[model samples]
Target chain A: MTPELPTPRVTVDADVLERNLQAMATRAAARGLALRPHAKTHKCLEIARRQVELGAAGLTVATIGEAEVFAGGGLDDLFLAYPIWPSPQRAARLRALAGRVALRVGVDSVASAEALGRAVPGLEVLVEVDSGHHRSGVQPRSAGEVAVAADRAGLRVRGVFTFPGHAYGPGRQRPAATEEAAALTEAADAVTAAGLDAGVRSGGSTPTATFTGVAAAPGAQGAPTSPGTPTSPGALTEMRPGVYVFGDAQQLELGTCDWTEVALTVASTVVSRSGPKVILDAGSKVLGADHQSWTTGFGRLLDHPDARITALSEHHATVLFPDGAPVPSLGEVLRVVPNHVCATVNLADELLVLSEGTQVDRWPVAARGANT
Target chain B: MTPELPTPRVTVDADVLERNLQAMATRAAARGLALRPHAKTHKCLEIARRQVELGAAGLTVATIGEAEVFAGGGLDDLFLAYPIWPSPQRAARLRALAGRVALRVGVDSVASAEALGRAVPGLEVLVEVDSGHHRSGVQPRSAGEVAVAADRAGLRVRGVFTFPGHAYGPGRQRPAATEEAAALTEAADAVTAAGLDAGVRSGGSTPTATFTGVAAAPGAQGAPTSPGTPTSPGALTEMRPGVYVFGDAQQLELGTCDWTEVALTVASTVVSRSGPKVILDAGSKVLGADHQSWTTGFGRLLDHPDARITALSEHHATVLFPDGAPVPSLGEVLRVVPNHVCATVNLADELLVLSEGTQVDRWPVAARGANT
Candidate 1:
């Protein structure tokens, strides 16, 4: 009998993914906060369902297309985590989605809040707060003005949320998490002072999740320990951790997770071996070109941890081993841990879930190309 | 009167694309070489047709799936420019494809050559040559051996091809191109000395296409000259320049083309503007996470060149502008030049082409997800 042909595939260690989900859930549970894992990482219904089963209070989505897919998959409470602008076309879709699920949309500006209120009469809006990332969100001082605008537009303004994205870099997570809590807490106080019910103060990144307590530690003066720590479990009602679902090179670099916890990898074959380089069928297209300067290469070869994929083309990856390692022979399959697991999954149509190294099932990357 | 909704888009400057095609064709024609532009970049039938019209002898594809698409589009002569080990399933497809078009497949090993020969009799094979990129291809000294194996298996050995992928990095292109020409010339000599018709001595990348000259120049003995130069017109038979069709951020970074030459961009909206960061609706999901460290951000904004997209999530690009520049208003549309144009195109289902900034036609990215 002939050997089977190697398929262009993404393999997920189901047990690892499950453990990661449980770990994050436990972290959030211990703090009495809601765990709303962002579905943008995996984009697989099975993973989303597993996250929900692991005690995710709600699902966070980055796009309406993603929200639609998760909602269609029976996830009733959805948060479109993006500050969606109300286009008439998207507004109709959001209205339809609102009818089916407990929908909460994100907003960072008075204009967006007004537009949302005009487009969907009874929409629940969350005032986005700028944590240390400084990406998208209102300043804590300006959160009240945006919340007041939302109130005037007849939209119910919920509490605040921030992404401690700055925690992603080296040695920045702890300080960033500290700043994140302070930013959300300040924003929540502003909203409450303005006579609005600041029901939720949400923030958490995978790298900062563990440092949430550091922000809550008290000083001897009977005052708050540090603004980074949450004094009350109800201070921030929710935590959103996406990449924890599939630990990637970024997560490893940030020391958020270990190699054993990396649940996703691309299965590729050594198609050619010449000189100091071994070429694999998986290239930038399959493994994804998401390398940072600190990353060893585009990805790490699981079979040889020290081997670095020095370069990648559309369909070929050039890997270099630390001198004297046995070169991979032609047709030998190898697993590559992508620099960014999220980008890698976006390239695949389906993901093969494995339990104890045995193929369990295949799940479509439902929102794989839903860019719009 | 209601204005027409803007379609999700990526435009091809037909004139620019044609000029690039003609330029490469003229270079190959002058070198007495055949021109086979790689089709993996655009992956559009229309662009492939234009390439053929501009005198490309055939087309180069990265996958059998891509080859099938072009073959079905009436392209009779093609080269699957990948070192694919032909399994029975792919072999059957190759045989079926052979019946439709003149197919040239790449092989880097004696084993793969034999497998191809056994899978599809009379298949035309090209011994892949490693010209210093170290991505794929066999060593120059091993070319004859692989050719002999292919011949022994009753396969027709066509010549050799190497991608000077190393030319992509900073200050490495000129040296890499010199090595590329030397490697290909050496491989061609080896093949001919082995009593085989090395009909094609093919190797060229967009960066090194100019450095592949036979004539000597001041301070540059045996240094490759631009393929665009008139002095070395008959040096190589075929040239594969794919990204030239749709100039990307990489092209700009390499100084290969100017920003004005960029033909494709993702149309996105300013969904949020809070604090110092402005969020765009298009993120890694649309623009793709193909950033090289040197790249300013995930992508360059067409209208706001000074604004750097500091961060990108799956559905959000967080852009930061310098202190004085006008922040993009909420709901404002923006065009983004992605770092890797090919990857971005692959992430979309369809592309809306514009003529003079007015939407004219829409083309499906036919081979969008053909990673296999």
Candidate 2:
């Protein structure tokens, strides 16, 4: 029998997690791409270990604090996937981390590359290119400038990386993956043309990870990336998709995965039922307040698909059930899938592992507050 | 000498914080209302101690986990202001907390009242009334039924509480405060008519707290609650506002506080400057992704008020400066004021207290992950 846990807790279905891990690992392996699952999604050392056990090359993090947490936990190979500004405090931490692990950081500007090089000379760095996100990365053609700056500053320029963040919207995965590959190829040429070896070409998001290489199938090993495109692989050497292991409402609504594949959910109890509105104890504090424009609500009820979270307070999620449907009784436990899994995981300190409706284990979110 | 801190760090201006605390305390004292600052805003025991030293009645929390953390830190008077569904696990914790401190809980349903009464008989419970937010609290007229049930179950039904959440928007504070007063008066009458002592009529929000009584001035004290209405005080006995201490974008937009009064900000470094767009190290992970419709952007730059954070990834904030204006130089330090102070504080594990640009002290967010 599984031990009863508290409400408003993040729970991971053990079977679903295993299947997701194996599926992503197998797909990346079949395409001959290194799988470096982004630890920013789960922030759990146990899940990172599972990913490594499934043949992941390394782990990707967004902050130096995350890298430190994962590295301190004995996971050596790490890549910080953001253009980190090497302040004096972070520089010392990065130098310490680089001394201990195979560390590679992302750089998008000459200023940042020089600062990082000054902070830790001979540090391995990757030039970040903008596929379409237009958030942080430089242009594909401009990658050479940053790489040359890093090389001139005695920092080893390893490769180019791009985040196809625009692929997050509905029905944008296939084209975004194609765009990512083309951008990586262009950036790699730029880096190599500047007398720097672009050893790695890294790019992938959760939505586009399923179509990373041209031959990746929906659920199999071989299929065309698009309807008319042939299986001509490009320069992306690795895939870094974080949210695949724990499918969220965004992925579910985007049709990236089925509801059964949603491994993570917030277990909440119905605290108040007023007419058609049922309030759950789980709110933004537990599920995270990441409401995308395309998201129908803050989150969706796992058991009752028709129930939509109309509003969220700090500690109360007001869900409105469809008319004439049987409302959930007060104190009835319900599972809620949040809009974004990474933000939700960041809000939690640990994840409750559930096996067949029973508590199997607990996984601490090791880097939960590693926001530096 | 000021020690270098990491970028995207939560820093509090000591002078601004002291002013905010003293102003709120003075206002509450002048109005003869108990000021129980919501601990969910800061979560730092040092800040809570400052509020208590300034004559706060106690503290208000959102969860039992927070209550437990505060109780362990030697804060005796605490209130959990949400309709908590007492599970066996939480029930045990609440029982322990009740035994250690003066505990008060919010109740809105018969089932929760009965369960709470059984779990900890004779515990103090306040009936939650929905003023206007339409979120968790019960209807103004239905407080008697729940109060009667609590009485029958041997629980002490003391007074009522309403969160004037509608006052959060622009130009709605005074009207919403009036609405809150009417609702609290109606609910208090119901509870008193049910043979329960309605000793506490608590109603508040950050925006409406300044207008709690009808005599609050537009920018001072002694103004009517609404247009053409006389300055007649209603049934609200006390006020609970969390965000007045650390003003946010929403508060600034609503004219509740000026930019100079904003006490907290995230210290970020400008890592990338691409034409008109500037990228900062602070993103949603540190500042929180709580964007209200009325806010200008994800956050605003404290130094350069014209700059707007147009986009936010997990680890980067893309700020857009006004065209023709001198942009921030690369590696320049900037302070970002987030949209929601409560959510922002919840995301941080600690706050750096700065006085005259010098790091004076550090305060741990003692209940950062107390979300159970």
Cα lDDT tens digits for candidate 2, B1-372: 667777788999999999999999999898888899899999989988889999999999999989989998888999899888888888888889989999999999888899888988888999999989888888989999999998888889888998988897888998899888878888888898988988899988899977786533442354335653323364667889999899988888889989999999998988888999998988888888888777888988888888889988778899999989899888889999998888888898889998988888999999997877
Relative to the true structure, candidate 2 reaches a TM of: 0.95
Task: Give the C-alpha lDDT of model 2.
Answer: 0.88
Candidate 2: docking tier: medium
What TM-score would candidate 1 get against the native?
0.91
Worst 10 residues of 1 chain B by lDDT: B227-236
lDDT of 1 by residue, A97-199 (tens): 9999999988888899999889998888889987867777888988999899999998888888888888878888878877887788789989999999788
Query: Model 2: runs farther than 4 Å from truth?
Result: A1-3, A215-232, B215-232
TM-score for the A-chain in each candidate structure: 0.94, 0.95
Calculate each model's fnat, 2 decimals: 0.63, 0.73
Candidate 2 lDDT tens digits, A1-372: 555577888999999999999999999999889999999999999999999999999999999999999999999999999887787888899899999999999999998899888989999999999999888889999999999999998899999999999998988998888788878888888999999989899999889987887623332345335543323365678999999999999898999988999999999999988899999989888888888888899999889998899888788899999999999988899999998899999999889888888888999999998988
Runs of candidate 1 with Cα error greater than 4 angstroms are: A1-5, A213-234, B1-9, B13-32, B170-176, B209-232, B274-277, B293-296, B304-307, B320-323
